[model samples]
Structures are given as C-alpha cells and as structure tokens.
Target: MNTLSSYKHDYGPLPSEVSSAIKPIYEELSKEELLERCAGGFTQNNTESLNQLIWKITSKILPAGSKIVEIAAFVAAGTFNEGVLDLLLFMHGMDLMLARNSHEYA
Candidate 1:
C-alpha cells in the first residue's frame, strides 16, 4: 500500500478555470480591501471555525453511514471556504444527496 511519505502531492497554482472565476471578484475589490484581506489571511480560517463548520455539515448533511460521513468531513475541511462557508455547505449537501441515493439503491 502507498504510504504518506511516498505520496506526491501536486501543490501548484490554481487551475485557469478557478482563477478565471475569481478574477472578476478580485478586480471588484478595492485596493485597501485587498490589502486588508491579504493581512487577514493568516488569522482567518482558524481551527475552531473550521472544526465547527465541518462538523455541522458532515454530521447534519451526510448520510448515517460512518465511513461516508467521516470521509465527507475530511474532504469538506480542505475545500471549505472561510469567506463563504455556505458555498461548500451546498457542495457537501450535494455529495450527501448523491451518496444517499447510491447507498440506498445499492
């Protein structure tokens, strides 16, 4: 089995599609706002908020299955948007709905 040390993670710049989507939003922000956002990056997405957001989504939206919900919690944590947690909430909700359908039908 593959181990953590052997895993090669591709930590590169965001894909063009993602960058493109955010370009408009980025441009719309004032220079001062952008600077403030940059300064706040380090303090934002704190451990407590991340934990609570993930817990609420995974525990409430995911199916009753332990494994699926656990995986969902982990995945949702990474993709969770500090600026807009609800967006990823919808994403987790979609995943849960899909999992529920497949799981129930299977």
Candidate 2:
C-alpha cells in the first residue's frame, strides 16, 4: 500500500487556503454539525448528496493511485454494505469523468 507521504506527492498537499478555511469550520463544529456537513444533503434525507459527499470525502482520504473500487470496498467495510459500495464506486467513476472533462476544456 502507498504511504500518506506518497499520496501527498501525487495529489499535492491541500492548498493552504483550503486548509485554513476548513480548519476553523472543522474546529468549531459539534459532532452533529460535522456529520451533517460530511453527510451533505437536506436534513433528514438520504439522497444523491450523501453519495456525492461520500465521494468527496473518500477522494481526500484515498491515495491518488487508489481505484474507485478499492475505495468503495474500504467504505463498505463497515455498515455501508456491498450494494451501497458498488453504487458509490459507480458514482465516483462518474464524478471522475466529469472532472476530467471539465479540466480538458479549461
């Protein structure tokens, strides 16, 4: 498995601005606030936002070289379940493609 140091080299460190912004938001957050932010959706709803948030958070935690399937498997290790993992992998793939397309035009 790749180390965190290697991952940082591949993706570049989080920008200082991003780190600064996120730090205060993270620090001031209660457990519920944190969960809500991470969960990413209308309150009391399970929707595409949840999946999108899962992808976003996983992208941060996962090594740059890690496959979406591998990340999905890791996420599925707990209460997330295999079916949900598969869906997440698919969503991650879609997000990656969208990102790539956007970058190509920029």
Cα lDDT over the full model 2? 0.56
Query: Model 2, range 7-97, lDDT digits (tens) per residue?
Result: 5455647897898889777777756756777676545444454565456546566565567645644554422444343554555666754
Query: Which segments of model 2 are wrong by more than 4 Å?
Result: 1-12, 31-106
CA lDDT of each prediction against the hidden true structure: 0.63, 0.56
Model 1 lDDT on a 0 to 1 scale: 0.63
Among the numbered candidates, top lDDT falls to 1
For residues 4-97, write the lDDT of model 1, one tens digit per residue.
5487657747877997998788777746766787785664556767677666766565456778667656665655643344445556676754
How large is the C-alpha RMSD of every model relative to the true structure?
17.8, 18.9
Error of 1 at 53 (Å): 1.7
TM-score list, all predictions? 0.26, 0.20
Q: What's the lDDT for residue 97 in model 2?
A: 46
Instruction: Give the candidate number with the greatest TM-score.
Output: 1
